[model samples]
Target chain A: MIKADYNVFDTTHDTQYIYRKLLDCMARPGKIQSIQSVTRKLNDFPDGLSTLLAIALTLVDREVSYHLISDQSNRVHNYLKWKTFSEQASIENTDYLFINQNLGEDKIYQLMSLVKKGTLEDPHQSATIILHVDELSIDQNKRQAFHLSGPGINGVTTCYVKGLPIAWIKQRQIINSEYPIGVDFILTTTAGEIMAIPRTTVIERKEE
Target chain B: MGYVAVTGGRTAIENANKLVHSYRLKDAERAIEVKEIESQMRLLVDRVMGEGGLYAPEYAALALKQTEGDVHEAAFLLRAYRSTLPRNHYSMITDPGEMRGIRRISSSFKDIPGGQVLGPTYDYTHRLLNFDLRNESGAVEQFLEDFALELDTEMDTPSFPKVMDLLREQGLVANRKIDEVEPFDITREKLAFPAPRSARLQLLSRGETGAMTALAYSSMRGYGAVHPTIGELRVGYSEVHIPYPFADEEEDSIYIGELKLTEVETVNSFTQNNQGDVEFMLGYGLTFGQNEVKAIAMAILERSLETQGQSPTQDEEFVLLHIDSVEAQGFVSHLKLPHYITFQSMLDRIRQAQKESKVETGSKG
Candidate 1:
């Protein structure tokens, strides 16, 4: 069904815009950027699917494989495969993993633990996880704040994200503890905002 | 003096572009059609296509005309255009053995099976320029009409068996095991050193004609030990097919179209295998269109890179990195861009050195 609706999305200019945004966010970790203009064109699709799909369409292709962890039906998985022509692979073998917000904390931990961190010689061969969260903001009022400090951050910066369990961050820390061999994360929200936490970025949660 | 960036050159740049357009059409002659370039300048189009790594003849012709016959620029345009396109389907592995050969030849054996078909080549012809071609519009039609009468249209086109198969049957040529692993795509991934054979072949196939030829020549001229015999050189059309998306069977595929390609397989000197059996090594080259020289050069360079030698051709990094038309041309052309700051810094260093030398001379006085 999404394949039939693909004509609404401009593969050229739209993907180019999304790619630039993705690149910007990836370079500056935890910096929230929005692709609301492009995703607005796909309003007919379900919430959060459009934003995730936009990112997937920009990055995934036949050369790469992706794994989707969603409590929702297999529709999103089938749509991604058909649209991008990227194969669906197991967690360890997949180059990308798309985790939906509906997944439980234990499921997220298991998925994160299994994702490939890649070997020292080929750190870039690691998986990139695209997770859908409820919301992301720089204003740290009420929401849990994450202290982001690394290659992209100047000294230290704070990113407040809602609905991302502490378990996921803990698991990510364990997996990425070994330098240069860790998975990158691209967090997207239903409102079409996106942020990146590359392997080089160190994320620390500020307890209340 | 501090370097300052030059500004307000927008109008000048625009005028310069207009001047270039005017220069292309100052003669006021009838515009040469894209189709004419595609058909008449067939070899040129083929060269651009091979280097550009895109097979569209019409696009290649348009690129040639747009760049005013600059081969490197034309190929660069095509490669840039290629980047914007999305990869939809991966074609099934094409076999050159099934090619409908228009021209096939072998220099390895004196009289091998599927004897050499010398189809449309000037290898034996004199190099003298044809004065008659200057105003031969009438002669072209007349020649075509006369040439058509000699052909037997009823005969089904002949397909030839590979020359390497004969050597392979006798175990004179080393038998390579079928590698089922998916080939590395250079476009998708950054090429790392000690590259896989797939990446090497991809880079070589799309390499610039003159650059590859020079390196291959260097190898043949005793810089390296890869003076290989042309085991088989075939120029022909090869069909491309993609697996049917809805098909349940593996064999079901849709025939997309055919591409004109020149394939070369070279036979090098023999060496002992792991089993201690002596066998000749094979070098392969294939390109988009009928570019015989590039393909042959590719074959030579392919073999040369595999061999351990001190020659430039034998060094994989040197040959592979230099052969890319876009990369080489872009880097060389970039020197023309504004480098005021860098140049100024260098000037400051030189002036400082000169001042120090003068002080030393005064002290001596």
Candidate 2:
């Protein structure tokens, strides 16, 4: 029933705005950007899936593939296909991956490794992971800190993220060690905030 | 130079727009209707439609009228207008061979199955202008009278078959293996290097005529390694078909109305295939409306770029990036925008360099 109810609102204007926000998030690795969607009540959707869905509705199309890692429900997959017309791909071949919740360290590592790392000739062919988390905060005591330095960052900037296992970052580092051939991440929260970490970013865990 | 920057910016902008409007309506001899432009200035409308990548004749006419016959600006206006439209169902694959061909020619072989029909082209016309239309009244009436008489007899025309089918039958042309993979839509995603054939064709279809012509000409003038002959050039209407939505129904597809298209197939010299067998490859170009020159040139450039020879025109990035009417026009027009800050920075840097040189000279003395 929810699959049939999924809608794309303010199709052009909202998509353009969301697209710019997504671009800005990727351009500035540690900066948090907000996405405004017609579906304002993010709590109605299962686990922070609204933020991922909002971005996916704007960006995904039939040309690319979409994979849902944390979502076991066919409803979400069918809803994504119906709304965006994007192909439902397996984890290995997906252009965009929607992770509805934080996974265990082992599973995270396995998923990261399994995801497509683009070839050097076509670096943008790599997968983009949209990860939904419980909270995203900069408080060092409450969240794990990340030292980010990349093409987008003016210099090194430290940012903290919550609701994800600390070991996941280490696995991400291992997966993204090869330059120009790695997956990117769009860390999202139920509050409609997102921070992008492209493969170019040099990530270091401040406290293990 | 010392004058203070003027205020009332919004008022100034409004007045500047009024000035342009006044110039546009300077004489007010006659009001030009969109229908008049669509009918009378047809070639210009076709060019706009091709470059704009939209096949709406009325809108193309309106865009041409709005831009005062500036081809690039008219196309830009049409493209901007197209953004406001909603995405409907994508039309099914179009077969140009099934077109009701008004004009069909094959330069590869002169005495083929069907003789060439040079329909409504100025290819053999004299370059001198006919001055009789300068003060001619009832021009439209005379034209309609002349053409309407022939329409009755011309209605029973036959469909022309593709010349490439002969080559395919003889195994002379390279065999095309149909790939079931869905083609990438360039408008949806950013174009990557070593682009797919679909994206390449789409870009070339919407490319500006003059730019594509220049690149193709360069390739022909010994800059590249493709000597192309127009194997088949067609100007006709291709029917658009879309699949019917109901799953249980027996009737599978619906016929959307026909779209006028110009299709060109160019035959290049023999080349070794991947398996080291020699075969003559083909280049193809198709665009909206009767735009044969652009399609022909586009076919050559498509082949040239595919070969990836040691020339600027053969470079996919060079040809694809530069040929877009919108992008090229936008970039060239951006120079007219106020660049005081950037200019001031450049001037400061130059003056500083000059002062440093002067100081060095004084110290040396």
Candidate 3:
């Protein structure tokens, strides 16, 4: 049995539970939910950032080559190390990537550099990313936005999230140049919420 | 300014060894002796080896003591240790028919060949605990001699066909054959779904005993409807045959694996088909010790699983997926690690979500 404290849980176990819950969420598609006791002790990293650790530990191990990118690679690396048991590698050679940056053209371009796109035979083996975004939303016109359409969404509805750089959308439009090969993203909140936007999702920037 | 130093590989290796030593030595006074564990707790030791997928009885016994009786952890320890040992040779698959006789039974036809040798069986014993076993000695040999004296000579009988084969011969059922791709060993590779049937059975065979029993019980209770009959259940020692590259197959010593006395049984063809006779041998369940029920359930579930209907037992994918004790325990218990980097990612996402919607962000939880 896992020990729990005063509404506080070990980030490790919490991440594992969250991993299963996230799997359920992803498979079900478009279900918005939050997990408890996950981010309570994740002090240095963002709240709910433990979700990334959950993903890493569940997915990455001795077998997978991974790269953890952040300016403060030292602190984050230690926690990542303890969480994932993953051996580190340079950004270029990574099979899985964890990026902590804003969602702008520069950041988007920065991430795109690491995309392997994979081979034609094994599409699932391609490089995947967990991009950390700060804010996302629509412009004043409400037309230039991330109006979504997919399995979970009932219809084409425009929903806005803030703190993301407008350039991120621009970069996706460029990546849209090719299909069947691109990156997948799981936009997770410091509060442990996540929205998965694979390379297949279309994104366009609003023109002033 | 907040970034910590990257520790060198040398120091990390030393620290890791220290951790392993500490874990191994946690129980100082009650350190479990390997020999006693092997002798007294034979079944548990056998189970550890059986599920661990290792054939070393002593090592499995040693691991059981180290784990303080956590069967899954003991299996894990044995497996982790086994992984380091290089594969020197491949074992020639032993034919179960060649097994030296100790005990054998057939439910389909009770009065068949060998007259149901009930050798070394605990079936007829009452539930009362016997304290006299501690003092008993040479009782087995005496019993064996007395049973032989009654028989003038073993009666010669032809090897009978399997119970399922009878159903298949009449064509009263459709032959349900599943053609799936090769599977990666779960221990050697990461788990992904929808996994192939081979992978699922590998996971389920070594699954936690209680959890698996519950699921099996549920299937019988109509959560999943599977009517299974005992085809054959046998307990005895079969030679472990390992084949060397240069040696002939008859040289059994070339194989380096243990053939512990085991009890393996499988469910027979219980398919109720008025239209046709469907015949299938569900599982060839193999285990280390006298684990009759587990092996039988495993076989029944395997047969039931291949059929793609809505029986609780019929949902092979679901039962196979969730019933793995080792993987489930490992991943669930693994939540004790740290994840500050992921938290940072979460912080970034929520701030963006809040800003886009113009909602005041709550303090990072």
Which number leads on TM-score?
Answer: 1
Tens digits of per-residue lDDT, candidate 2, A11-66, equal 56677777899899899998888874543633456647777777887778756788
lDDT (0-100) at residue B35 of candidate 3?
92
> How many clashes show up per model?
0, 0, 40
lDDT of 3 by residue, B211-288 (tens): 667777777777765556665666656677654443335464554544754444455455655555444444545556
| Alpha-carbon RMSD of each model | 4.0, 6.9, 18.7
* Chain A TM-score for predicted structure 3: 0.74
lDDT of 1 at A29: 91
Off by over 4 Å in 1: A1-7, A20-45, A118-123, A135-161, A177-181, A193-208, B1-11, B139-144, B147-155, B175-178, B272-278, B359-365
- Classified by CAPRI criteria, candidate 2 counts as incorrect
Question: What are the per-model DockQ values?
Answer: 0.49, 0.09, 0.01
Question: What is candidate 3's CA lDDT for residue B181?
Answer: 58
Q: What is candidate 2's lDDT per residue for B243-343, written digit by digit as tens?
A: 65332463578997998999999999887878887888899999999998999989998888877567987899999999999999899998986767778
* Per-residue lDDT value at A176 in model 1: 90
Model 2 residue B111 CA deviation (Å) reads: 5.8
Instruction: State each model's TM-score restricted to chain B.
Output: 0.96, 0.94, 0.69
